[model samples]
Target: MSGPELRTERLVLRRWRDADRVPFAELNADPRVTEHFRSPLSRERSDALVDRIEAGFEEYGFGLWAVEVAGSGEFVGFTGLAVPSFEPPWGRSVEIGWRLAAHAWGHGYATEAATAALDHGFDVAGLPSVVSFTARTNVRSLAVMRRLGMTYDPADDFDHPVLPPGHRLRPHVVYRLTAADWRARRTG
Candidate 1:
């Protein structure tokens, strides 16, 4: 499938451009934005990440597209689906995630962009299910998961492998939504 554009009421999910680098790097550098992450990536690292994200779109027909405000065209950040690389509480899983600039918080952008991504994942990509997870301490992200109609599975929550063994960030909660659940939510 060719890469497709996803539009929401206030955002546009599309391919990334070289022009998005600066804002994208800025978003990655913010402590608040990367609070649950390992660390703020340097500009060079951020550039490499963008390259990988773009490649995923090219190769897989979908990925974390660059998200921008519909009006001023400002780059907010990205939201979409990714294959979780490391082993965790849920084992191997398709994880949906989002990261937006600090200035873009509190406006439901994550929810908006994620809802679009989930739609594309299930309807367009034919995924059987999608899961989201984050460090249990990341209340904000957990709230976003709840807003997206995902439910927590305590049995699925596990220690994240990437962090130092036994670190606080290692404990994570898993939320899941299957295609049927998504369809029901969309129809209702």
Candidate 2:
């Protein structure tokens, strides 16, 4: 689907491109980038993931966007909205997420892109709430969630249903932002 493009002060969140495939594969394969994932994706698997992301945009009008640096147009990574493929303890919900090249880390890109995505999900899509989750140990993502004003409750933690039992990344923490909360944060 030709999804809407979102612009931030330093990033552009847009649909994937043919040129994005190679670097995206590289990013997906980077051990640092994939540390939280099950494993680094093979080239074929990365391409397949891009295909699925595009299909998701087709079906939902929203999906993980290919992020690029604003002026340089350098492909960094992605940040956007998605529906979790597996059911979580909180039940079905649209999620906000991001992943950036290691070089893109510590620059506030994730939080900035994610803020725009949240605006779309809550303001444009009229979703009542959006959720985000990560391995309990992923402090970077957890901090981004807080920066975006998503509140976490320890009670919401759960083992990722897709992960094997006892997997280190199995235990996950969930954070959520309601439309009302988002509006308040924006105006207040």
Candidate 3:
């Protein structure tokens, strides 16, 4: 199914394609890219994730958009909204997230793409708020959350249900952006 596409001055956020699989897999397998995760993804697992990403769009009319550079059409990575089905406190929440290739790092690509996704959730989907969570040690991601105007409450931090108890990455911090806050930021 065809999904929504969003364009920025330098990037295009759109549906996945057959051509994106290889590079997408490479991105997922990169050590630096997946450093904060438990481990890098195998090709088989990477392919499965693409299938799920595509299915999300078909089911929800929105999902993580495959991101590419606007002028050169380079496949960077993905950034968009997702319904994270985890556990209590975070289950069934709309989340904005992203993953870009190592080459795309430090270029503000994540911030740009994620802002579009957050805007889509707040303006198009009419969501009340969107949340983003990452490992407590992932300072880069936390920076992006801040750049997107998401606020953090130390009390909202929690252990990720999917992660093993006592795992190094289990502790995560949540950031939120409400519709009212988004509007005020945009029009104020």
Worst 10 residues of 3 by lDDT: 85-94
Deviation in Å, model 3, residue 111 alpha carbon: 0.9
Looking at model 2, the pairs that clash are none
Each prediction's TM-score versus the true structure: 0.95, 0.98, 0.96
Each candidate's clash count: 0, 0, 0
- Comparing 1 with 3 on TM-score, the higher-scoring candidate is 3
Q: Which residue segments of model 1 deviate by more than 4 Å?
A: 88-91
Candidate 1 yields a Cα-based lDDT of 0.89
lDDT of 1 by residue, 1-188 (tens): 35889999999999888999999999999999999988999999999999888878877788998999998899999999887766655566678999999999999999999999999999999988889988888988999999989988688877777789867688878999999998999999
Candidate 3's TM-score reads 0.96
- What C-alpha RMSD separates each model from the true structure? 1.6, 0.8, 1.1
- Name the regions of candidate 2 deviating beyond 4 angstroms: none
What tens digits encode model 3's per-residue C-alpha lDDT throughout 1-188?
A: 57789999899999998999999999999999998898899999999999999988888888999999999999999999888866647566888999999999999999999888878888888889889999999999999999888999999999888889999999999999999998898788
Runs of candidate 3 with Cα error greater than 4 angstroms are 88-91
Per-residue lDDT for 108-149 in model 2, tens only?
A: 999999999999988988999999999999999999999999
CA lDDT, every prediction?
0.89, 0.94, 0.91
Task: Using lDDT, rank the candidates from best to worst.
Answer: 2, 3, 1
- Best-fitting candidate, scored by TM-score: 2
